[model samples]
Every structure is written in structure tokens, then in C-alpha cells.
Target: MNEKEILERAYLEAQKIVSENSFREFDTSLCENVDFLIDKIGSNKSIVSALATSLLKKITNPEQDIRLHRTDFENGYSARSLDTKVVTPFFKRHFPKYANKESAFLTLSTRERIKWNKNEGKNLKIRSKALKRSFLNVFEQIEDGNANPRVYLNYLFAKLQALSSKDELIFQLAKKQSGRSGVLNINLIIEMLQRHFAEKLSSRLPVVAIYSIYEILVPNLKRYDNKRLLPLQVHTSSDKHGFGDIEIYGDDGKPFEIIDIKHNISIDADLIFDIIKKTTTTSIDRYYILTTFPDGFETKEIEKAVNEFIIQTKTQKKIDIIANGIIPTLKYYLRFIDDYNLFIKKYTNNLVKDAKNSTEIKTFHIDKWIKILKEYKINNV
Candidate 1:
């Protein structure tokens, strides 16, 4: 079967298992095999993606041997390619939390003499011989046609569901707290949000929050009247043109302004150098390197380099580079916003829709905001 057909089949099977609760009847041994892998790997997503992709491909075409994952196996198809092109996309679409750019085969190299044969686990990075034996033993059953692939797939999906379960401590706390009722204090709200950012809920949360602020501020700012704020790119994305975390376009559709938000990381000379490379090619009018780090940029030498680079870029390329603390920038932007509620709503919506954020991160954002409102009595009745 083609990659698309196999992906569709896997999705259908997953839906069937989930909707009908068919995994309840999976054999204990099959479930135990997945458990063993999880215990050994401690929720290594790459291994899980690799195994799922291999099993789904096997079930799709049982006649073809899927032993050597990197090879085409004379079936006019490469399992590694299938993992990269098809399975990764499926993971992104159906299970965005575990989606990555490349395939798991990148880590599990089955090349040269190290084929997925009897000695497969020995060649792997697994240190213990017993663990290696257990690893091979699990796949041995599948390779020898002993374990039913469909049943195995059900158990695998079941194990993944268990691993992906959400934490509810914050949810419980939020439920018990009394809702506050009073007029909103913009300063208090900013302080609460700043504290939230300080918690470092997730690396993606700050970027999204910053983007949400820009979403509100950009339309009103006279300087951005002709400029357009670009859509927020996935935090894990690598190909964001030459711009940084956030990009603004001019009337000509070229990047006019860029902002790169760093989470709890000090901007040093190395980062400044990278920015220099990025700015050389684009005619961007301004670049902002905002960081959650209290110290902002690194040592005095690095700070000097940053200032010099800024002046150099401004003089040579007309590219203005400003390095500052993220929270302070947000606080300044909040002064321009008339309705602070809009900021909260935008941030909440972005958190809900962000594919990269875990359930804990999303719940914490809502719960923290709730806690802040109750403590400050900032909520409307």
C-alpha cells in the first residue's frame, strides 16, 4: 500500500480502537511489551513513533517483511521514508503533542551491518544486555508472526494514551477557589501575567503570549498602520524565512520588523552573531531581541558587542536592533491597550489552540489567571 493509504488505515484503526474501546480486549503480553519499552525508554517519543509507524506499515502489507526499517525491502517503498513523509505528518495532524520534523529512524540507524536482525538490540545504545534481550524479544514475536499486529497496534495506542494523560492538580485548585468580582487593575493584571511568564510554564507559552499582545497592539500603533503582523509560526518550526520568532510585513510583503523572544536564556555574543547573519540578507527596518531573563544580555563584553552591532547594523544596513527585557516591553505595550480583558482572552485562545503546548501548560495558564483574579478581586460580577 502507498504511504497515504497506510496512514489512512492507521487513522481508521486508531479511531476504531478509541471510539469503540476495543483495546480493552488486547492481550496482556502485548500490553506488557509496550509497558516494558516505556519503562526502559521513559517516554521517549522517537521510539514510540518508530514502533507505531513500523507496526502500521506491517499491518498494511503483511506480505512484505519490515525487518530492515531503512530499506525498501523490494516492495518499492522505504519504511524510513514512510516514517518521515507520512507517519510524521499523521502524528502532527492527529497527535500534535509528539509531532517532530524528522523520523525516529534518524536516531535508530539500521545501516551497514547493524540491521534489525537477531542482534538488533545489541547494536543499539541500550547498555544492559537484559534490556537488549527484552527489546529484541518483543520485536522477535512480531518478526516471527507470533504476535498479532492488529492487537499489538491496539495495545501500543493504548499505552500512548496512558502516557499522554493530563495532570489535574491545578484544575482541582481552580475549581475550589471562589471567583473574584471587582474592577480590573491593569498593573495587577500585568504583574500576574509577568509572574506567569516567570514560572516558565512552557517554552512556547511566552512566545504565544507575546504574539497575542502584538495582535492587539499592532493594529492601533501608527507606525504599524501600513505594516502587517504575520501569523504566529509553530515554536518548533525551523524555516521561518530569515526573521525571528515574530515577523511583520511591509506593504511590499517583505519582512519590515522582527522580534525574537528568548525564554529564560540570556542573549550573548553568539546569539548576536547569528542575528547579524540573519539581518545581512533582509532589509528589515527593526529587530527586537526580547528575553525573559532579568539580566537581559550576558556579560559586559557581550553587552558592548550588542551595542556596537546595533550601531553598525543601523549605520550600514539601516536595521535597528534593540535588546531588552520581555516583561518590561510587555508592560510598556499594555499602557497602549485600552481593554486588558482583550489581552487575557487572546492569550487564553492562543493557549487553547497551540499544538505544541501540553495539557498541563494550558490548564496552568487558565488556573493561574483564575487564581490571580480571585486574589486581586479583579473579575467582573
Candidate 2:
């Protein structure tokens, strides 16, 4: 078989393996199998090896499963550790000629190797740092090789860390490469979404909460726009209320006509009325009340209530008013809860609130509000 034919077969087999497994351990471990398939079909070793390595790297390292350790205890004991150690075998498999067997014996030659001394107290900090540095050095050597798929894969993997930092350079780079003209890398897109959402929810809340929102919205955003919209929080104070949160703006740098966000069961109608009234005074073109309990309130009832409020504002003309709750679509809600739980785990108790009874609700459900705007055909310039 030709190179193309071998690649075709290997790709099909890899797809099958990925489909059968969970997202965690899907296609990452299929490097050997992919290479074997290519070899059996008489493909070029170098090209097939590169392709197989790329596929393996692409499918492996699900960010959701990346090990995050919190060493709060003395000597840096961490509850979060990987079950299996990840060893870079490229030096052994691909660069045996360069492997320095003598380096392993250098420590032995120095006679400095010593077993753990109970009285000496474990220097876990030094040990952990040294281990991490050693592993990184090996990775560097693997990456420095010829145009192997693993080299690019490793580069991409390292780039993933920058996404969390809200690094504009990294984001721009990913956006540039996301198109047909570029690398067409989905992992970069995912990393961008994760970081975008992470930064969005990072303020006034715990990292975990932001992460939860990201998990829920990232996949949905990918489904809708093939990218995530940067969410912005707008602060406004009403005359009636001393100070409050009002609207959320999209990346377009304009606040949406309508704003929607999750709230606790105990919602303050007075505050809601104040927000609606204050919004009218400002540039807000329309109003909406989005809640977690969509089914709990009748749409007609809220509509009637809103109409009454409009009548009360006799000075201003009647405006479109939308009040409804998101029904928590199966796919979107599940992802939201997963990311929310993760966020809660990483942040403070006050920053993370249960949906049961939290009064500090704000207007920032930008994604859902966007949907509502589209549904109503309401456009705000």
C-alpha cells in the first residue's frame, strides 16, 4: 500500500479507538498502533512515525484530566497526584544514539546517593523541584529533534498553559492559526475558550466557579460560533439602589439590549424593578429577566408584570420586555454544573454560592442573553 493508503487505514483505526473510549483516555495512547498499521501497509517509517506521533499527542492530555496538585502541608504533601507517571520515552525510542548511559552512573560515581534518613526530614520541596526540572530537560531534548509530530505537539501542549494567563499574544496566535490558512488546531481553540471563560468568571468569584461556567459554555460556544465570546461585566448604580450590577457586554464592546443571568430562588423584585428602570435611563435598549427557574414562572405572568411596569413609566415610551428562565438544556447545563463544581473547589466559600439562596445576583449571563436577543430579533447598536 502507498503512504496515503496506510495513513487512511491508520486514521480509521485511530478514530475507532477514540470513539470507543471515554474522553479522558481516548486516542492519545494509539501512537504505537497507528505506527504499526502504517508499517504493515509499507508506508515510509519517517513520515508514518511523524503522523502517528502527532495523532497521539493531539488525542492525549485532555485538559480536564490534567493533574493539579495543591501542596499545602509541610514537606509538600499533595492529595492531587497522577496515578501513573508520564515518562517521555522519545529519547529511548527515537534517540537511543544520544542517550547518555554514563549520566545515570555519574551520581553513583560521586558516592552521593543516599537513602531516606528519618531524622533528616524529607526535603520534598527540593526533591519535587529537581524531579520537575529533570523531566523538563528530557522534554526539551525530545522537542529539539527533527520535524517529528511530537515536537509540534509538545510545543502546542506548552502553549496550552499560556491560555490561562489571559495572554493576548497567545490568544492572537491561536486565533490566527484556527482558520484554514493556519494549523487548524482544535486544541488551541479549546484552550482559548477555557482561558477566556476562566478569566471571565475569575473576578468576584472563585476560580472553580469560573471554570464551571467555562465547562458549560465552552462546548456550547464551540457548537455555536466555533469560538467563545469574551464576556464583560458592566457596573451601574440606580438612583433607588445605592450601587448595583447591571449589564454584560459582548466582545463587540457594546452592551446587549437585554441582560440575563442566574439568580437564587429568593429574587428581589424591587431590585429587578430598579435595574429595569435605571437601564431605561441609560443606553440600554431593551430589558430581560433570565433566571435558573425557567419553568417555575409563567412567561405570560412575567410579561403581564413587565407591561404593568412599562405603564408605570408613563414618561418613556413602551419598550420590549423579555422575562424568562433558561430551562437548563441537557448538554449545556451538565457542562455548566461540572465546571461550576470545579470552580467551587478552588475558591473561597463566600465567592462560591449555592443557587439555593444567594442575594448577590448580577446581570452577566451574556451567552443566554445573546440567545434571547436573537430570538426576539432585537439588535442593539
TM-score of each: 0.77, 0.24
Q: Mind sharing the TM-score for model 2?
A: 0.24
Q: How accurate is candidate 1 locally (lDDT)?
A: 0.66
Error (Å) of candidate 2 at residue 37 is 55
* lDDT scores in order: 0.66, 0.31
lDDT of 2 at 257: 43
Best candidate according to TM-score: 1
When summed lDDT is taken over every stretch of 10 residues in candidate 2, the lowest stretch is 79-88
User: Best lDDT goes to which candidate?
Assistant: 1
Local error of candidate 2 at 15, Å? 42
Per-prediction CA RMSD (Å): 4.9, 21.2
